[model samples]
Target: MNRPGLVASKPKNWSIFQQKMRNFKPQMRPFHLVIVYGILFVVSLFITLYGFITYSMGFEFKKEYNAQNGQIEFNVELQHSISEPVFLYYGLTSFHTNHRRFLASRDEKQLAGKDISEDALKDCDPRISDGIGIHEKYPCGLVAEAIFNDTFSIYSNSSLIKPSTANIYPSYETKLFRCPNDDCSSQRVNVTDPHFINWMRPQPFANFRKLEGVFVDGMPQGVYTVKINENIQGGQQSYQPSLKGSKYFVLSTRQWMGKRSLFIPIFALCISVMCIIVSIFYMCVSRYDQHLKEDYLQRHSMKIVQSSDKRQY
Candidate 1:
């Protein structure tokens, strides 16, 4: 109060801040679309690339052998481009977990194949090979016969199915892929070994949304014979197979399933996109409100000055 001679403190330059915000408001408003599109584009690009890379290499298959139950279980997804063709087949054989017994059994040879046709059916033991057929539209169109050998053995007691036939065992087959090479069209890695464990695990199924959704369990053991044409990718046909047993299950047709696990990345990407959008929106609204406040303050201050000037006159 005593300092008339001293310089009065300068008022804050709120006007400058106001003007800067005013200029920023319009620019910020138009940039919302840019922010949203940029985020979505980036996310889409990432997923697309990931799909391409994984699809080409194929998915992995995993299985766990439960020693407690002596059951081998695995979940599998077989994918082959229409460009590539493959055959899948499954069979139940009288196999034991006892290694010594398995080795000693002279009757452990692979079973001969049976066809549904009378000519083909008549050649085998009818009791074992009945009710098998080749349905053209099946997921794995060709069915192959597998032999049953009860004396077969594995390495441990937990490895064998009890009362062997106590459980209604079913076999399944689905074509995984056709060989890419011209000379090897019918070759299938899965059908080669009676106790086939993948040398490298097959890639996991794509678009998987849940862990349990695609889980499977089974054992593979057998030999496969393939037939292919020199003409790559022409004349696909199904072969009917008759087997000696009634207890087998096979997939009926090739069908599309929603991929599992796609939701994780998709959810992540959506959240990230939302964050970017909200940030931009906040920045815009802040600038707009600031501009409106500044305009009101400027107009009021001018009117007060005019009234003061008039009074002075």
Candidate 2:
């Protein structure tokens, strides 16, 4: 008897569950699907545009080369907007001829610090008052010593002339403006040598200036390297944990990407186009199906009404 009662109660509960399920309706509609497809299409378009822009910009090539007896041609472009004088240190490396191993020099590491400044070189020998001291060693100041020493040589292929030791002391004239209260004064300084300027100069900004020619019998027809030793210490001394300067190296004539890079933008554009086509196809199919259903319903209702009218007549 209890088994029969349990079976009966189970049927009643199942019937009530079935009734609830029959009344439940899903909220998802065709409009919701359309909106989702539109969002996806928009996102894909943006990605395609980004890929195209990046591909158009092209990539920059930077490599490092050890200073050694080799021939190199550099076509460099540099821009300097800052007021400070930038010292460019060039030197020959002591590496094996066939090794071609380019290693950053210890002197380059020392120049890569922020602790060095004009104030630090205040006691530097060969001061402006001392005149141009043509000596083997500078008593003080790394900048002075590096510039004065004939440690490196660059022979121009076009002119077929070697630059004099004194020619390294090149300068340019620029107008500097200072504002005190409402009064403004402008002064021009012969911005040639960094040693002569006494006031605290701002950080030197450099861009590729130009490439004259190659090193005489340097490296083969491959990517070569050149290290730039910057001797300006702009940051505070206390902030620097170690007393080192800044030396940066760049690899030249090296393309960052190959022919495969062109495929990236093409693939992105294809994906975007596919998404648009798919969305449009689905939208058209959905509208067509909706129209067919409405036509069928209208024809069926008309048939039922005609039958009722015939029955009434």
Candidate 3:
């Protein structure tokens, strides 16, 4: 519809406008643009290299074990020799600890060694009770309920290698949190346990490994037998209620930065590549634009000189 006071004009040609846009290019570019991006490329590359170097600072060895009829007993031969004071980590995949529902499911006071009324937990709602008792699941919610309870026992030859769990759980955690049942014998949770403490800390990732224990006298190159007490499907199910995941563990030595992770180096490498690519693109544009400006100036100077001579005549 047309406005009351306005009249439409003949449609203007768009082909010329499209042609001008196609040939248009910026005449002026900051001369130092290339230098700035070049520096960025160098800095990002250095970071990528540093990340890889740090990743290689320590040694890592891993083995995957699957539950068979609820039993995970396997012998893994350590191929490479690792330094002493090795750390052990049990890993689980497909467990989402960062889920909003799971994270919001536990009662803080109850976990902090205080006995609170079930009605106080409005966020937990129907999840508060699983028909176990009207009293509610002691450490209610999917978060606490889905706690990992699998135990790992590693042996060298016929001798058992006992890893130290001393100070594994925070000293203050023992004081801050407590099980509902005094002595915590009848409770489903042992808040003081190192494994329990570490698990409760929460991981924002689904596939991850948590520190299990440390071997003061690190592992050397040899065949070690790992006997896993598979509870969820075998001994007593302490992992995911359903036996549907790849359960494994690793024996690794740490640098000052802790265990080796792929996130940092990979991210740095990607940034380095992007910087180089963008730098190249901009360099090409700047060089071509410079040529266009020079050509325009040559034609303009010639016209001005000819007009001045004609006026003089």
**Which number leads on lDDT?**
3
- On lDDT, who's better, 1 or 3? 3
Q: RMSDs, each prediction?
A: 23.4, 19.7, 11.3
User: How well is each residue in 1-313 modelled by candidate 3, as lDDT tens digits?
Assistant: 8865555453445867445446556544545666777788788788778778877767677877767766677777767776668888888887788888778877778777787777886666546775675787667766666677778888898899889997666777776678655678877667767777788877878789888999887778899888887667222343445646567778787654457776766887888788778778888888888889999999999999999999999
Q: lDDT of each model, Cα atoms only?
A: 0.33, 0.37, 0.75
TM-score, every prediction: 0.24, 0.32, 0.74
Measured by C-alpha RMSD in angstroms, how accurate is candidate 1?
23.4
Q: How many angstroms is residue 269 displaced in model 1 relative to the true structure, after the best TM-score fit? A: 1.7
Instruction: Report RMSD for candidate 3.
Output: 11.3
Model 2 misses residue 265 by how many Å?
4.6
Model 1 bad stretches (over 4 Å) = 1-260
Lowest-sum lDDT 10-residue window in model 1: 206-215
lDDT of 2 by residue, 1-313 (tens): 5698777777455657657556666674555666777787788777677666655553333433322232334443332121222223321222121211111111221122223333343334333122444421222332322221112232233223232223232232112212222232321122222322211121233222112222222222222223223232223221113433222233122112322145655676777787778778778878987999999999999999999999999
- Residue 309 C-alpha lDDT in model 1: 100
Order the candidates by TM-score, highest first — what do you get?
Answer: 3, 2, 1
Name the better of 1 and 3 by TM-score: 3
